[model samples]
Target: LRETRSYTWGLVIPDLTNFGFASIARSLEAHCREAGIQLLIACSEDDPALEQRVVDNLISRQVDGLIVASSGHSDDIYARIHDRLPVVQLDRHIGESRLPMVISDACKATAELVRDMASECGAEIYYFGGLLDLSPSRHRLAGYELGLHRAGLEADPARVRHRDYQPSSGYQLMAELVAELGAPPRGLFTASFTLLEGV
Candidate 1:
């Protein structure tokens, strides 16, 4: 009897409806094809239980590796699978696992970008951010504050708004900001592309 080799990887992300995630999936798929590996993709829609189910399904399929853009759950679902196969965390991480991870330097970059925008605008700047519960959103908000401080500008509570990372939330928040300020700020920084579209 001969054993067949498995060269398949599993990827679990929040949602492909977001262009960013879709682009990542496309790139991963292309890379896998070039390397003669099969790619299995799943969307968790930012739900913890859903993510777990997806991971379990991937494990049952006997994937060579797993990549997760985590849902910030505290459970050790990924850890349990670690001994069977390699696991890599992407973007966000689970509560306190020491799993290998690939995360962006969003904080420093965001701060620099905001500083440049403020310099160009020469007026008050406003931040339209995502839900505070998420790590990325929290980091970006910290960056926004750091940028204002570095630019010698004070943080204004009225100029900072947090909402779901959705276009409708962005639109509604922008409308409220406009009504409150009577005009758009000279500089507006949105945390996500979908939110930017609404603004």
Candidate 2:
């Protein structure tokens, strides 16, 4: 018998149709190609059960590594095998996930955006964010609140909406907000481009 390297890895993400995720896949594929590793991508569609199934499938295939953008699932399932499997969480994370993570400074960036908007608009700001169950959404909302506090403004729960990341939801939320306020908001912050599309 001889030792062999399969030179493969698996990636699990919420949605392939999302521009952010697609761009990530492109860059990752290029880097993997340079290193002579085959990259296998799986879409979880933000479903915990489907994500687990894909992850298990990848593990069974004996891939050397995994990158996951989990959908509210804990890391306990992978904690036991990570020493051999090398699981890495990406973009999103479970609360205090045991796996190593690679995520951006979403909170800082969102807060900065809020400040700029407030400074320029001098109007009430409303945030259209995704499900708070995900880390990214929670961080962004926290940033929004922090930004308002820094601007000497109180955080208004009525102005902040936490919903799913879908254009239809975005559209409906905006419509209902306008109906409730009797006018369009002066300052608006949408968490994702897809959400912005609906606006």
The number of the candidate with the highest TM-score is 2
Q: List the candidate 2 regions with Cα displacement exceeding 4 Å.
A: none
Q: Candidate 1: where is the Cα deviation over 4 Å?
A: 1-5
For model 1, residues 1-199, the per-residue Cα lDDT tens digits are: 1444579999998878777778889999999999999999999877778888999898888889998998765637678788878999887756677989888877898889887787887447889998687778878888888888788777788778888877888899899988887988788999988788788
What local lDDT score does residue 50 receive in model 2, on the 0 to 100 scale? Answer: 92
Give the Cα error of residue 159 in candidate 2, in Å. 0.3
CA lDDT, candidate 1, residue 59: 84
> Which pairs clash (backbone N, Cα, C closer than 3 Å) in model 2?
none
Q: Estimate each model's TM-score.
A: 0.91, 0.94
Candidate 1 lDDT (Cα, whole model)? Answer: 0.84
What are the lDDT figures for the candidates, one per model? 0.84, 0.86
How much is 164 displaced in model 1, in angstroms?
Answer: 1.6
Q: Single out the weakest 10-residue window by summed lDDT for candidate 2.
A: 1-10
Residues 1-199 of candidate 2 have per-residue lDDT tens digits of 1545579999998888788988999899999999999999999988889988999899888898998888955778778658787888899878888689999988899888888788876649999998888999989898888887777778788888867887887898899999999999999998887788777
